[model samples]
Target: MKAPAISYWSLQLLLGWINFAMTAPMIYLYLGLPLVMRQQGWSGTAIGLFQLAGLPAVLKFVLAAPVDRWARDTAGYRRWSLVLLVGYAASLVALAGLDIGKTGFTTLFALAMLASLFGTWADAPVNALAIRCLPETERMRAGTIRSAASSLGAVFGGGAMLILHDRVGWSWPFFVLGVGLLLALVGLYLIRPVHLDTIATPKRSEVGVRQWVGYFASAQRRRWVVVLMLYFPFIGTAWVYLKPLLLDQGLPSGQVAVVAGLLGGVVGALGSLLGGYVTYRRGLHYALPGFAMLALVALAALSAALASHASLPLLTACTVLLALAMGASAGLVFGMMMYYTREGLTAVDYGLQSSLFVLTRTVVPMLAGLLLDHFGYLGMLSALMAGMLGIGYWSLRFVRGMGEMPPKMGRVA
Candidate 1:
């Protein structure tokens, strides 16, 4: 019997819910945990080292190999997702049993690291499943959904979790997050698995090293890889440092939190959705160039505002523009990544691109910090603006023929 076709919106919502569930706990670990540790009188060094718990995310490509090797069909991918998500939820529930106030740092850190590892590993199968199930026409919407879900996750994980801890206690936050994850798991179970084309089973000889590295075996793939690395990181680095800039400009900490944390997240989410709609209405050729232009304008405005030490309202406007640019660019870049993923090796290809995406996003901030130290805010902004302009030009030229490329069924080699 033929299964009922799932509507596009239904699939996006389910995928977005899964993304939200996966993201919130990690955000809590990264954002909420540090604040708690600081309040508990933990040393700055210890708290700094706690950030290492997130290192698992950067190794997604390596972690994805097993899923690609084993989960060669939609049903197999769903099973892998269930097992990994169980590990993720179980880790959170376990954390709920540990009292952070009296627990040893090593114990808490180890548990948190395990949670991150499970969450990171689980993302591969989830995304591969999205690629498998989503039609080519709806891929951009899927990216927008991810961006919006991530923003909501940040608010819940970074903001709501901290508030819960403040009003209740440490364990409640963990408990609540675990419950949320399990709810998403229930939702996943309720949705009937949709079978698309089956991936060809790899021969034993083709299952090892070549499968891992085959994503980079072609020139066109390499070009897209460069675009993946460069396109969004410049704007992203600026967004990362925006809060510090506001503080330096004499905005109160409370105001900075509201502006950068809450307001920025909402605006960014809206921007992501809008960008996706535009991309869907026009073509990638039109959407990519338009988004690149928007980013450049935002960067220029931000630079000008910083250079002049503009009024509070003006500064806020500039911040909103930059946030929107960052969000819009992310929407486009994610869709592009999906567009570039190979058919048979969806997991491996998506993992490699995502690894590079995350790696560059991580490293560029350190370099940006150095630039800020050496050249001040104005200089750093100028450097970023120039870099964006250059990269934008190159990306447009490189992707000029992206419309000509097949949206579905990319060649493995």
Candidate 2:
């Protein structure tokens, strides 16, 4: 029998909208902060310095294990989620004032850093909320919907920065964006999901920590761990340094966000929708390499763009392609992340493996930025292409089809 459904209703749609809005300001912050710095007479090094603000996400795994160990009572996931929502909203207000040009950049940067920490903390519980809400069979659908919503959020955030800054104001975007998150907080009340009586919580003893870490050390062949360690970092290659790369090519600030959302988010949504269907129908085999190739092609186009001094039209085409590739790849990677890790132990049993996945995502992308800064865009894109080639090689050794693993433990989620 198929697992239970999340039941499409007002709550889920509201959740989608609110999450998008709550996240919108930061997304703008990431894009706009650098532009603000550049215009403020700051150097690229200073702008790149802001990325260190994301360090909490990389290290949240240490905290994630503790979160996994305790599942709240009464409200279950909702209880913790509400706390995170409040913290996140308040941070949005502080973020509006982060004039990196001012004397207290370190202090403002700390606030920005806190926002990422809270956001990732919120992500852990919300992901659990998804596990509670959707069945395995329909998760691809759920992921597709979630990603599309996120893409829409990106579009809205990006578009606001692009079009509205001229007329409304720079900080004005924060007001609307902050309200978006606040609305999401209200959305939880509307969800009213049946309490997950069978909800998975880590054992509060040594057994829990052992089990959590034990999965990585499993004797299955060590290949799965290798896969996770080796290739996942490469997944972020194309857009890793995209903003800096674009600005270096001379795209205007507002246009950078507008095109990123229009092409990256809107076009990306279409790509994700199509990818979800393919993943649901065919399995990971077709899904992984197909998306990987799309990314590889996008990289080739980017190399050509940079080599040609970033012809505007060529760069625009590159942006859309990269966005679509990333959209589909999001499904491929996360879908695989879910399938490979928890099904054997049971979905709710995801407490251990799930946290590791989250940890890696946070760590890997942070590393991507550093690597991008060192290598320059073209050099990093080339390295990313190499990363894709590695995944392609690894996939050949391990995958049998969707939901099937060749008996070697040689897969990465």
Say which candidate scores most in lDDT. Answer: 1
For model 2, residues 1-413, the per-residue Cα lDDT tens digits are 32234454443465557557655666666765566567678768767788778665555445445444465332556667788878887887786665544646677678778877777677656655655554455445556656667777777765666456547655666666777777777777766445343344433433254555666664432555545444445555456567668888898966776666466778877777788887767666666666777777877888888988967787888888888787777655554444444422332233444455556655666666676678766677777788777776775554543244422111312
lDDT of 1: 0.82
Q: After superposition, how far is residue 167 of candidate 1 from its true place, in Å?
A: 0.7
Error of 2 at 341 (Å): 5.1
> CA shift at 72, candidate 1, in angstroms?
0.5
Model 1 weakest 10-residue run by lDDT:
404-413
Question: How does candidate 2 fare on TM-score?
Answer: 0.78
Can you give the TM-score per candidate against the true fold? 0.94, 0.78
The digit string of per-residue lDDT tens for model 1 on 258-360 reads: 8888888888888888888887777667677678888889989988888888988998898889888888889878877777776567777787788899999
Clashes of each: 0, 0
For residue 38, give model 1's deviation from the true position in Å. 0.5
